[model samples]
Target chain A: MTMPSTPRPGGRSARIQAAVHQAVRELQKEQERAELTVPAIANRADVTPSTIYRRWGDLAQLLADVAIEQLQPDQPPADTGSLQGDLRAWLIEYFEEMSSAPGRAMLRDVLGTPGHANAGKCDGFLRQQIEAINERALARQEVPIDPEKVIQIVVAPLLYRILFANDTPTTQAVEALFERLTMPTKT
Target chain B: MTMPSTPRPGGRSARIQAAVHQAVRELQKEQERAELTVPAIANRADVTPSTIYRRWGDLAQLLADVAIEQLQPDQPPADTGSLQGDLRAWLIEYFEEMSSAPGRAMLRDVLGTPGHANAGKCDGFLRQQIEAINERALARQEVPIDPEKVIQIVVAPLLYRILFANDTPTTQAVEALFERLTMPTKT
Candidate 1:
């Protein structure tokens, strides 16, 4: 059978999208504690297997899209008017989302998926959302650092802990990350 | 029917392992720009389907183990008598490896697979390896940074560019990352 096409529109399509996303979230919650599958999610969501495969291209892509949709738009980390303040605020928000149970679960799934590098469009959606905040930090010029690099510095450990070690991102870990990132070196 | 079990004898086991790894690698190369599957690999390797399924525990796990086996052992950064020097050297090596065509391609595949997180024990092996290096860096006081945070500082941009943004990790990116991590901030 042919796979369904992208989540395109009519009233029915939007409704399906909503249902699928909700199903994805619920499945993700289950995923946090156990395993998940399209058939299982379909049974729960009451959508057919053809409906999922046809619309989303694949299970991972669908979930990544749904997860991206769930991410809150990046905010201009508090205007503490300092790079450190901005970074702290930015990272706190970023990590809080990442460290949350759902976020952690989603990340674990994303990194665990094979052939993820080819999923560039989805990754771009997430990165751009992050980069916008980094750009804001750059405009402030309170800290003389590359905005992209700063974003990477702040977010990397949280992702690593969640995906690899299955550990929570602690405050001490965050603080240390911040300090080392900002310390001067022989640039 | 039960999956194929491991080879029965020592020499046979080694032969089986070598054949499996070779098959997996060749399959990866063949599917460099497309999707890969167990049947395709089995056909190419001239192995029975049961043998592949039994030994690798499915495609993702099999591939993850192959990738993990391919990773080089981490080397201590040259003791240039300074944390920055040592860290720079170490990270440069990391940056180089992660940016290499094969490295990026393989990683993308690892991240691309849906349900990749369930890949037996090899799912997070690479990240754990990176974490180990971070721990070593801390113990050696080579970077004088908190050990835990070091993983994020070094890896975030590398993976972000490779996995998310579709950019090859570059010397400039590594240098910029180094600067961000080394800059002084409000202690």
Candidate 2:
């Protein structure tokens, strides 16, 4: 079962994938992901079920593809010069995106879908985003922070609030997370 | 709607609630919460759907009640006497419970259910548990820590790993979380 990261650029295949993804999102807005059917998505996308089956193998794979595509940052991480500023900006952007309708829908699809090991796939995407920001921090000569530590301290709490508590992290909470991570401590 | 903190005292009502809660957990073990229907649950519990509706109003409320019941601690907090010891013991207990099949099932039911405001319900339950622990810490004369901060630092990270990352927090990681929370910090 192959999972295409993105649609092939400027071709018939690209158009098909785009339509399929759009159809999936629209269906998701109206119904639960588990209620989504391959034939229904194909009918909406104006493609054959066989085409979808051959491409994505099943609903889980198709939804994963759409979720990943939606989660990709619109642009590279902004250079905010300091590690604290950069981390704060990245996290706030992430929080805002995750609290939006599309982002929550994507998360619900990936997470709520049963029998799908989409969590590992989503974690990889999240780690890559953090690594990119860390690279920028390193470039600015800041002491490199542990990515795992960062995930536990910053990302995990925010995500817990988003997914489990269904609460949006306030700006103060976001800044507190950044401060707790970046502040120098007396061991 | 009156949400009983505990199942009503020994009587027909208690027996019914117990049977229904058991049926809910069994169904959750076999399938996702969203797929659970009132008829199926009623059949399993040997009660009529109207009975469930009368007591809980709907599937969401019934599931919420079951989830809350499963999450409530049976015993009072263990007093390890010291703040560090108490925190460590409490966290380890929580981690083990959350990593269990039943705990994960309850979480999936609360989180995976669409359009359910179960998050707030779960959060309140969690906060009550934390307060009970904090009360013990206060009795031992340790300065009371913020329950929300404890959640963000200790609980959220472990839960995020369990739910999203699918990675179990190691013993060292758990200890690190407790230490981070209890250690005196320079503000």
For this target, which candidate reaches the highest TM-score against the unseen true structure? 2
In DockQ terms, which candidate is top?
2
Considering only N, C-alpha and C atoms within 3 Å, which residue pairs clash in candidate 2?
none
lDDT per residue, candidate 1, A1-187, as tens digits? 1223354566688778888889878877666433667788788888998888887666666766666566635443466665566667667667777777667545544554445432355455445554554566567653345555554765655665655555577777777667757532222
Q: Which docking band does candidate 1 fall into?
A: acceptable
Q: Which lDDT values do the candidates have, in the order given?
A: 0.60, 0.75
Give per-residue lDDT, candidate 1, residue B82. Answer: 48
**Candidate chain B TM-scores, in order:** 0.67, 0.77
- Count clashing residue pairs in model 2: 0
Off by over 4 Å in 1: A1-10, A30-35, A72-90, A112-146, A164-166, A179-187, B1-11, B32-34, B74-93, B109-155, B176-187
Interface RMSD of each: 4.7, 1.9
- True-vs-predicted CA distance for residue B175, candidate 2, Å: 1.3
What DockQ does each candidate score versus the true complex, computed on alpha carbons?
0.27, 0.41
Clashes of each: 25, 0
- Which 10 consecutive residues of model 1 chain B have the lowest summed lDDT? B114-123
